[model samples]
Target: MASVARQARSAPAPALLSIGQVLAKLSPEFPDLTPSKLRFLEERKLVAPARTASGYRKFSSADMERLRFVLTMQRDHYLPLKVIRGYLEEMDAGRTPELPGGAVAAASMLSAERKLTRDELIREAGASPMLLGDAISSSLIVASDVFGEDSLAVLKSLVELQRSGIEPRHLRGFRAAAERELGLIESALMPVARRKDASSRARAAEMAREIAGQLEIVRSSLIRSALSRLDS
Candidate 1:
């Protein structure tokens, strides 16, 4: 199968854009984007811009679209570079693969997810006001006037867990556990986060998310193993 790099070159190409132009077009939506970050992304092979005879980078409109898709995944899903690259590779090879972080959209290129009001959140999550209050008090979820899609998902899951007699208050330790994991991630990222560039900060953010994803997998696996023991 042809690699994404080769396939990216297979199209009826648009006028090539310079790095500054790419930054200009993208920076409004992604304020922290920088030349160094673009270079970092290219280094990760998440994007493969064409090169000039003198090695100047040239980006096509297709490349821009791909970059937009990639940035969207990273920003919304917090997916790792490797995962994003794999997803791109799968698409390039004509396969419809599941997105990492449980994203169902085949392409979120045009996705601008909504933020819901408190009442809207409760209605959409199928949760009661009291349950949401309890969840907030127990630190299982944050108390926000406006909530994101992820907040709704968490609230809905809490509702299901409540049916199993696991109230939000019973999971108070979860917040502490999450904080402990966060501390570890922050410590590990200190080396990168200490850097004085926006690119380094962006890189650190992605790395933190990648580590968090791995931690979540381990946590879920351990829970499954414990449940299996109960069944046995």
Candidate 2:
């Protein structure tokens, strides 16, 4: 019976990964992850690994890929877990998932081939003309012949703020704060970004975006905590 059980566990299944193996494979990519975190991800239904006869969880190659995708979305996108799960589901179904823009989206918008005129940006962002002008003057939005989706998103946020008695002028400090953060990130990446390979350069860029996303998460959490205190 022991031999039968052993055989059952070892039967030519598609390559199964032990917990240690999984950690070894993924740790470099997600330095902060631990066994508990992997389990937590499983609890959240972000990953479902196969179970061996001995009841040990065995991750398949597909499971590893799914995990990579999930971690990438969270670290790089600063997306809520639920949103990342939805995107993963779409991808699993062979669909091209549209990722959220966060700050990287803002940067991309500035480089888009087509730009929106000031009126067009305001119309798309649902913002007022004065608010757009304020954003421009504050350096939040550059005066460009065209605007990208990032500009539109920023404009939309500005419109929302306006309803809450916050205006573009109130956010003037944001640009200065962002510049400081960017300096820190650039300094941290100096080693990797200095590499000559295209792949390394691309990876450094992704890492920069991921770091920015994490920072955004921290900032948002801090703001929410402060707001809660006010309510109390």
Candidate 3:
């Protein structure tokens, strides 16, 4: 079997992938990918496609697959680009990078996992119906038939907050604050999000989520640091 890189080099080069063609191939899996976002990924050195004699970019099947892997890791694992790049570099060096156990299996599991019914979510978080209602009313958890990992994380926080009498209503401002932060991210990604390609749009969304997750981590760390000062 031809190596993925070799196959990419041997594939017939298109005249150029009109931003449209790129989206058609990549969008089903990555619905939010856009042309500018693709360029942004290039700028970050996550992907390097071949340039035409006239400077037009021409991606290969291999490039597409590589991109799929990279985007999937960022979206599902919350991995930063630097860490993802390191993993790719290991693969490029002819070593099979050891993914976390059942990583591939886990990818398939996400949709089902995200389909947690209301009762299931309450059970998982050990939360009561009243608490769940408060969470939804406060916008800390969006009302949905099925809940994703994001909802679960919020539920976990609510469980902790319950102990301190910080009910869901008390954290309603958190939802508003998150929206404000998201607005900043959307503004930064405006140029990229304007493109019509699905892959680029998907990649942009994944990038936004990754950045938001990082911000949440930083915010948590700062709060913990401040609390330690009080303890001292």
Candidate 4:
């Protein structure tokens, strides 16, 4: 143990990473993270990376951890930047504050995102290969050898719906509905998209997120209203 400690002490520290390197390390899990988004997060004071003598940003390991936490909170819980910033501030002040809405904690954020093989996804989601195949056939899921978290989530939901006698074939209309919504978003974005400038591109992405959030609110309200009628 002492020899191990001595070796550890002799080891070199990790190098500070550039923005591109940070993105390369993180983008697989947070595919939507772009340079502009990182800058936006920095502007919001979610993270404070170091600036080089030449004005380039350099991120330490702690910065990476904070970024992962912020991104995970946004992706999984859909928490807004203000809420997340408040929660983080509490933590920074040496208070172990609970996350609002029971969001996942910091420790879990450090783990790498899972990418499962077809068989692994089936096993993990408790879904049958045939069900997955049917889902692909129905355009509910793309055919892929390796599946990401979104695919796993969909498969898990399908498994529960399957138990209730709902099949992938029955949800085929969902794909079409999604395409229509995409069309609407694209049409709304045409003015910004036509600008062909970096800032406009970033604004377009932010606008797309805002529009999608509003649409989700409308969709969820409709579903809840329909369910209330069914219950009545």
Candidate 5:
């Protein structure tokens, strides 16, 4: 054990990372993490990376972990920046603060979603470029250089549907239906949005998710009921 400890102590420390390096390392999990976004987070003081002799940003391993925590909280819980900062401040003061989303484990602090490039997405989803083109043109999917996990899932389902001879063209009405549902959600949120507080905005976002979930349930039930009539 002492020999192992000695070897561990002799190990090299993690290298400090540059901003571009940080983005490249993290963008797979946080596809939206551009340099501008990182700068914005730094401006908000959510993270405090060190500076090199020439003033370049240098991020230590601890800084990377802190950033992962902050981004996970923002992405998963939709916590306001002030709230996240306050939690971090509590931790810095040596107090164990509760996580905003009732998180029970440290793993919850590292909720990075999957990200894929356009070609990678197609390969992973078993989809053809023509299908992707049709999906985009029909508004079934938005064209992007990088896609989130949801986009991959959608494309995979489309691939299965394609095998069954159901094409993206057949799903064109989905976009209009989704837009109408979004309109409803927007109308519902306007009152809360007008309040202009961070708390209000957070609440509105949560409520909007809940309402969208309910709308999805209703839509699913309607489709199932219509299918039941055909079976009858």
Candidate 6:
């Protein structure tokens, strides 16, 4: 079986894009995208762009699509890079792996995310405008003209919580808890983050994701334990 790199290299040929070209194509959609982020994605094995004799990176069309998928998952779903890498590995092996959140199929990698308008977001989430406004006010969701799937998911959860008589205001502490976790991640990442190289920055990003994944596991376990106690 070919390695992931070999598989990427063996894809149907198209005009390969330089890193700058890749940035040009992707930057409009991902304003925070930088060469370092691209390198970080590559380091995480999420993408395997071809290299020139001078060791410069060149992305094939498939590579570009793969990078887009990885970035989308990270930005929209807040998925860790390792999780994204595993999904891609399965896809490279010709297996249709389920997306982590089951939001969409792996095949959706080739397409752009469906940006939802404010009204559309509320409609899809089966949430009322008041509920959405409350979520924004609670700092659980940001106010924006156009929302992404994440916002829709949050609003949907808010609607369900309302059924349980839980309001967004009741979850305000979640934002502060998230900040605390971020502070922990930043502290853990300081060693790598201090380095001003692309490689180190990439490593720091990957480390942050791994730390966040661990924290999520701990949080979920605590919730389950508390729920079990309540049942008992």
Between candidates 1 and 4, the lDDT winner: 1
Whole-structure CA lDDT of model 1: 0.86
lDDT of 6 by residue, 104-192 (tens): 53434546667899889988999999999999999999899898766877898899999999999999999999999999999999998
Give the clashing residue pairs of candidate 4, or none.
none
Kindly state the number of residue pairs that clash in model 1.
0
Sum up the clashes in candidate 6: 0
Worst 10-residue lDDT window for candidate 1 reads 101-110
List TM-scores for all candidates, in order.
0.81, 0.53, 0.59, 0.73, 0.55, 0.81
RMSD of 3: 7.0
Q: Quote the positional error of residue 224 for candidate 5 in Å.
A: 1.8
Tens digits of per-residue lDDT, candidate 2, 44-95, equal: 6899998979899999999998887667666644555666677668877999
lDDT of 3 by residue, 1-232 (tens): 5699899998875554545677788787676576876786787788898886888787777787777766676655666776677777888899987652246434643552356899989999989989999999998888988997668768978998899889888887888898889898898788879986766676667667667767878898999999999999
Q: What lDDT does the true structure give each of the candidates?
A: 0.86, 0.78, 0.76, 0.85, 0.81, 0.85
- Give the C-alpha miss distance for residue 211 in model 1, angstroms: 1.8
Task: Give the higher-lDDT candidate: 2 or 5.
Answer: 5
Displacement of residue 181 (Cα, Å) in model 5 is 0.5
Q: Give the lDDT of residue 196 in candidate 6.
A: 95
RMSD of each: 6.1, 12.2, 7.0, 4.9, 9.2, 6.2
Clashes of 2: 4
- What value does the lDDT take at residue 48 in candidate 4? 98
